[model samples]
Target: MSSSGTPTPWSYAFIRLLFRFVLKIFYGSIVVEGTHNIPKTGRPCIVCANHSNSLTDALLLVTSIPPKDRNMLRLTAKATQFGQRTFTSWLIESAGTVPIKRRKDYVEGSVDNTDIMQHLMEALELGDAICLFPEGMSRYHPTIAPLKTGVARLVSDVLTRNRNNPDFEISVLNCSVTYMHRQHFRSDVLVSFHPPMTFSPKTHPELLAPIDYNNIRLLTTQMHEQISSGTIDSPSWDLVRVAKLAARIYAPLGTRMSLGDHVRVVRAFLEAFKAAEDGPEVDGEHPEEDEKTPAETAELAQLRLDLRTYQDQLARWGIKDDRIRRQPLPRHTILSRIIVRLTWSLCLFSISFPGLMLWVPVFLTTFYAVHNFKKTGPIFDTWDEIAQYKLIYGLMSGLCVWFGSAVVTFPFTVVTFLLVPALMWMTLRWLEDAVSAFRAFSALVRLLLVGKPTLRAMHVRREDLHARVMRLAVETLRLPEDSEAYFARHGGKEKGRVRGPWESGSRYFSIKRRRKRDWNETLRLYDVVDYPKE
Candidate 1:
């Protein structure tokens, strides 16, 4: 097999058959819209969407397309997913899959996005249709997250390579997959496709290339509008109405809502449609930020206003977050895939109490919280960053507890009590980079179990998984850390500079500019978080 280990045509066919059976058994009345929008045939193009469920969406896409078009689909599955099964892993590589390390918190670690961009450009040059999810991962909220500029970069690179010849106009079809029960079983799964989106000038340099933050913003707005089409069917809810509703909802949320927040509202509105169509009765778990004590409510209110302002800017561009109801997907629901994770702090708090310790859970959740800006599959995104490692971080702390108890059992009980866990914590902190690869294997298995179809316990191999993670680390992250621009974030250089969410010190404007600044554009606000470092 080729080194990347993409699945072969036969393997993909098998995978498609297998998943089709699963969909038949579990997902009923699957409805796929916008079929007319798919080009009968075209140059290698991009597929972008917001991620909600798991890689099952990949199966849906592959299954829906004809075999002739199947080969044309060189899906960019996250390298972390390579270990579901030995054959499955092999199949992924044989499919001519490129092992891109998009988000660093992956099992194999982060990717060199720049290299991935280069690889993607070449794939497009071959007239291969490259499928990608702009959102990084499945989001918990009703809305989409802010996207990384990597997509813009990919679009830019492909067009740049074909600058001399613009005969092949790129076809980017935005598909919105809505589920009846995103967390339940035997639900309806509906996927809607949109007319292919093309850059304005039909050129790369001034139009598509020289990608900037605003370009990233514009792309996000259009995406918000596109995905919302099939998902949101409200006749009255034009871009204007949605914009106004979003403003009202966000008006009181407070000023801290980043551009990401505005994006999420649009994402949420779309998700609400998916939930309404596919989900059973998903009462959001997180308490309404809009409803809280006076001080807290005011804080949320201000954040809400900031989000509306962000949306308003896009509305001015006439970027429509409109709705065009088409047929919905089949009926089914998402199963409870939530492997509830506990943090180390909670563990410490639990063990500290006697009776409560007796009732504490024996096993902590092992899943990692990977955040992808915008994703295609429910789980896999074009780029992903680990938002919170509290899951695995707590796992490490548990080991520290057992090892700590044994290492100092003989003497100095107090010293063991005080120093062991702390020492263990500090020591393990250094291992974060080293153990990251292995941790990804554990995370992948969890994702497959909770997200992918097939409920029986999976026979996943760890060492094999670890090896792939290692390969991924070498191929996706270790190398690209030196290259990709997306990997580059502003780290504060001076003493007064504030720490960024990801870095030890993120740069933001001092409080001096707080009142006068435009929250969206000002350095005083709009701080970005990196995958891990943030």
Candidate 2:
């Protein structure tokens, strides 16, 4: 046991501390409940959670398990991951992950080996918890996959073999991972822990048998219900799900949609009605194709239409359909992301470099100044957006060549003349960022000084924006006038802006979000409206 006794080890404490740091720093949350329901001192236990995303759910749970029971948490992981040379793979093993080989063709002895059973029992007999995803594989959509009997049978097997520890317990948490933008920044995740499933049998004559499993089935059905409804409100943010629900709520208000905006609308339907396992096939009866409530059927029809439109637009913009569909950056393809990142990170590491490394500074400076110019946002039609990145890369590659020439031919007059200006430009950009950072810090201080007044001013503005946006949306949608009615009630709000502005007394809000690139250039490319020169 690494550290689960009364006196915990420095290593265990360090691990726990490290988990908190990582969760806060890198875009995750531990929104679990009913942790207390799992006994601190009990018989063998198994923990199960829904699988979504690549590794976020398991990693979060692994990091959150109490150290007293840390060693006991014998987690199961994919075999290939264990073979990888990555630090995460090594960490997985060191943290005591059991390798579950993906079996292709099942043979007599090949099915669930004795060694695996031995490992699981050894872990439980020693009073440790085993964690696993019963679904066995991750899914992209937000819904609980079919519950496997592995957990149920595992508990049954453990009890039959041990025969002695009759009170063994098992816990199952139905978790949903909602991504904001799969490939974007500050993505949110949500975790919900349902009540535990204690082993008990309804038919066992021996009054005292394995922890009640009849109780467990009831628990799982209950979990499926909560997750299916999207009602488990954990503190963890569901980035993609949130946006979708927001879009559904806000779309009716005439908010012109973006591709991201469209996805959200489709996502709500997917979450609510997208059945995972196909139900019994319908015969000739063919249940009403439009059986959905009139409003729901209309929404579903609209989502399908919107998705077609969004995809066509992406195609029209020359984005290869395959690429947009396969946007999740692969763990192996990480070098590509890193290269693109370090093309920028050359600047980060340069700040700590002994001297102003020539290549790094110039690259960073031009990149920053160019990006800042997009504060007002550039009108990049899809082609223009694609072209902009390529141009930047060409410039960066050229700059790198120049720096290389200067370094290889030091003291060469011609090289120095060109290198000197580029070097100066880089240095100037760095200086500007440094200055900007300081000014930002000072502005924060001033905001603090004028906190209440500034807050009040912001509140007023937000309220005004909200009111105007509502008025505009209602009018655009051609809804019958009612002073007491709202866009939310008419089902018009879209793209995640709710009447309740994530704060109380919110004064104003903007539908005009200024992301670095105004991908919606189509909307504003024209200087004047149809009624121009009025």
Candidate 3:
């Protein structure tokens, strides 16, 4: 196992490259934005993000960093991950993660954070960037959990030591990661970085004059707002669903929307609906700024009802909005595409046929193992853990099969072992392509079966809904349907400015931006009483 200290740059780069490949295989697409916001190499900084997935969040965040500066990352993991002397432990430790035992993860009186805090401080002093999930625990939720005080406290303590020295400073970068399907294989994810939040004597002289409880709270609130802006935070899953559907329906047919833009549209819907529900804040400073007229509020309500109706309509058909958005092609056109897709799948299958013969047993064993194990698998609190277990089990099962085969074919052992990973890669490609082709065929068949009149009716309804929503988004929210136009209007000359919906302290997001309520108390308003620990 490698030590937790920084590794050689080359080694770190190689590891990053390896994980990048692994992630690409696991996810359909990993879109990273705001690379420009990453702090310079050797800068003392803390990278913070909302945690929804368990280990996958960390892997995605770490690999998203530029290769040259990847060596500067020091990940923070749960202490339990390093408790066992196993490959999992070695892998995490080799990644240079410091282990922190959260109070909830152990007996109430058994956890200590002194060493963990020391390690993080030392890492920062050495100019290494430490990454942490301020929300503490990873779980499936519609919004960010209440942040723990660790990050705020750490920054205050570090600043206290530096005392009024402008030469020594620390930056905090907030990365927001969103998953299209957190547990599904080959789903998409987006990682967005916002401008770094810096705290130094030159920037904030008051914090150094004396950091107090209020200062810590202020820093924590700022961190919360920054991270929240970058992520998809909603009051409930119902709003999340409705918002996603509205965004989907609002898009033009066959338009390729970036994950960031899609997220912005969804946030627009969520904030608009939430604002109407929360009603006017009489005491709000900018009451007139965002106070929607009665007609507009009623229009929003009508839009919500229409969106829900459309959602149910799509659900009844058991199809995604994309299917509806895809402009109808001539029968011959779809048939031609189907044939091409099938032919491509056949070609890939033929190429991988030889490897499949050798790896079929391993694949079947893995399938059966996962199937049986899941029944008795350790109960997990998050959907990401299900994927995590599949990954671990698949790796272990494949290795065992390779070792056993090597032993059985003693003389050809070297060749057998060498071929394992290569064959596995070929099989993976074939399976993915074949499954994709089959899904396309199924969708095409369903399309063919549906009457053209029904499709036309659905299209008409979609178009009307799209027009109304886009108008409201443009006029009411000042968020245009066209992402480029919105960016141009807002002077987002640089990338990562799809945040217009939440910018300028819009009254709709007033509670989120101003954070008037205590963080914990606000969490209770969301009915999340069981606060997670870091």
Local distance difference test, each candidate:
0.44, 0.43, 0.68
Tens-digit lDDT string for candidate 2 (269-300): 34333321123234534465523455554543
* Cα TM-score of candidate 2: 0.47
Q: Judging by TM-score against the true structure, name the best candidate.
A: 3
Better of 1 and 3 by TM-score: 3
lDDT of 3 by residue, 1-534 (tens): 112334445545555666676677566557788999887766788999988878778878878998565465778898889968876676677776789888788875777788889888877877778999999988777779888878988887787777746687888998888876665555667799999988776666666636567887888888899888876787777777777776655553223355666667678778888877666667866648678777777778788888888877766655556667646667887788878877866776787687776666755765675567557633345444655554555556666876887888889999988877677665665555555555556566666677567777887888788788878777777775575454335522122233446653352223211211111111010112221222
* Per-model C-alpha RMSD: 24.8, 16.6, 10.3
Candidate 2 — worst ten consecutive residues by lDDT sum?
Answer: 525-534
TM-score of each: 0.42, 0.47, 0.78
Q: Please identify model 2 stretches exceeding 4 Å from their true place.
A: 1-13, 28-43, 65-72, 83-86, 104-112, 139-147, 162-168, 182-185, 201-300, 303-534
Candidates sorted by lDDT, best first: 3, 1, 2
> Clashing residue pairs in candidate 3, if any?
none
- The true-versus-predicted C-alpha distance at residue 431 of model 3, in Å, is 4.1
Model 3 poorest ten-residue lDDT run? 516-525
lDDT of 3 at 169: 81
